[model samples]
Target: MDYVFTVRRVSKGAFKDEPGSTYFLKVPEDADDISPDQKVGAAGAGMPDKWAKEVLAAARSGENPRTVQPKGDILIYVHGFNTPTTTMLKRHRLIRAGLEREGFEGVVVSFDWPSASSALNYLEDRSDAKQTARLLVDAGISAFAARQTPDCEINLHILAHSMGAYVVREAFDDADDRPAVASTSWSVSQILFVSGDVSASSMSDGNPKSSSLYRHCVRLTNYSNPFDAALSLSNIKRVGVSPRVGRIGLPVNRPDKAVNVDTGAYYERNEDRFRDIPNASHTWYFFDQNFYTDVFQTLRGDVDRNRISTRAGTRSELELHVA
Candidate 1:
């Protein structure tokens, strides 16, 4: 079963593009096999707390009974703009499927905030993304942080894609203002951004805009593809914004813990294989096995950044190798 924690309002048995109270859901991979009447109801109030306990317990106990790995991590996937709830869940399953194919045993969860599922609604989605950012902090991150034990062997991580990067940055900013310990003191292990949609300058070493993000994560890895047409300079949706870190790598003054990996070389060489995919440059990572290999290594937290086989060059300027 895949876990989903959504903040999208339900309308006529489907998720609509409007913010709503947070709810936790457990969806089996074969959910299509079951009728709508057989579907379970959403968890009730205090559900986030219970959900966190269940997730932490599962993470603490290895999913595979014979494996003795001391640690298991949960990766909270935050999707980009223009994605409906169905597409969001599909991506969650694809991510989990890719990770499992590489022998990953940890759980994958999603934080699905409302996104106006239209290509023309970029500005509208951005507004909703900002409005819903606090929900990610209050319900997702803080909930898990409160339940984590002092000696906990499990790690929590985040993988934000495209505009989801904006959501994450804003979520940390919102959490910074909260007086509660869970909100202010929470941290994650690895924070990865694929096709990040935030401005490059905002994440530079000394920029106050991302100060809270820098303070909270142990490491931040950005996967940039210069060929991403969706984030290119000509994209009208970003008319007045500066260059994106997802299209152009991080600014020269990036934080000490931040690393940029240019995936352009690999993508260009493999572009033919992805020609059928819409906006392949920006969305191809999840569909590539080699990409998942790199993600798996990153989440394992043992391999040095420069030593990962799927990448080449120094840690400061790595290039994703073509598989």
Candidate 2:
């Protein structure tokens, strides 16, 4: 069963009133164009508190030994920009099914932000994504942290794709900027950044943007590929850009905190990746089942980073080439 709790970020007027489908959104091309999306019966359709509460409850339930409990981890997935609202729901179910097929016992919670879904609206989407960061941290992470009693041992894992990495990073930034709302003690067990679209230096040494994030997460894994076309465009499209973490890899300086898994070798070995415009390499995490197996091992956090695969590149930058 798909155990997904949806949080609609777009305003009510921006969403179509669908009976069966709960989420339907209009693309936000201009900041002033669309109304803010919210709850079912909210004034002007304010955002719902139920889904966030539901996610917290699910995570809490996973820790209950007295009640029916799950044997594995709890995942909170945040998708990148330009993703349509309806497609996001499908992706949630797809992820749950895929994880189960790959021997992972877990439930997934998807945090849906209002993305314009238009490649041309990159600026608009970026603005919207950054602002949504606080919502994820406050409503999702903070609330979850508050619910934990002295004996709660639920494992929390995070998976972010593409621009979703931006969201995660910005959330930490938001926490640092606004400490009153930030839950400093909410330590994430593991985080996987799949083809992240953030600046490569953001997570490096002395970069305060990542200080809170790295401090909060026990382990962070960056699934990178040099052949990611989407991030290549991201570098050129954005002003004052550095090499992206997803395209190149994380800085070697923070090896203890973040491990860069270079999946580029897999792409070079598999020539059939060019069937799509963006290339199959970018989406391999979802398309390949073995990747999920690797992810399962990653969640364990006990395997040595070097022992997992052959290490490539210099000591300043390490890349794991896993089959």
Scored by lDDT, the top model is 1
**Candidate 2 clashing pairs, residues 3+ apart or interchain:** 10-37, 11-36, 11-37, 12-37, 38-46, 38-47, 39-46
Model 1: worst 10 consecutive residues (lDDT sum): 32-41
Compose the digit string of candidate 1's lDDT tens values, residues 53-148: 667766663533344445678999999998877778778888998998988878898888888768899988899899989878777776787676
lDDT for position 281 in model 2: 58
Write candidate 2's Cα lDDT for 1-323 as tens digits: 23332344333455421112223122222322223352333432223455434444544434345644543467878888767665565556556667778666556877666676576667777887786677676656766666655554667888998888998989877787775865356767898999898988888866888887887888888989998877775545665667789898887677476788887876677547546523355665666555676676777555666555345554345565544
Q: Model 2 misses residue 56 by how many Å? A: 6.1
Report how far residue 66 has shifted in candidate 2, in Å. 17
Model 2 TM-score (2 dp)? 0.78
**Model 1 pairs whose backbones collide:** none
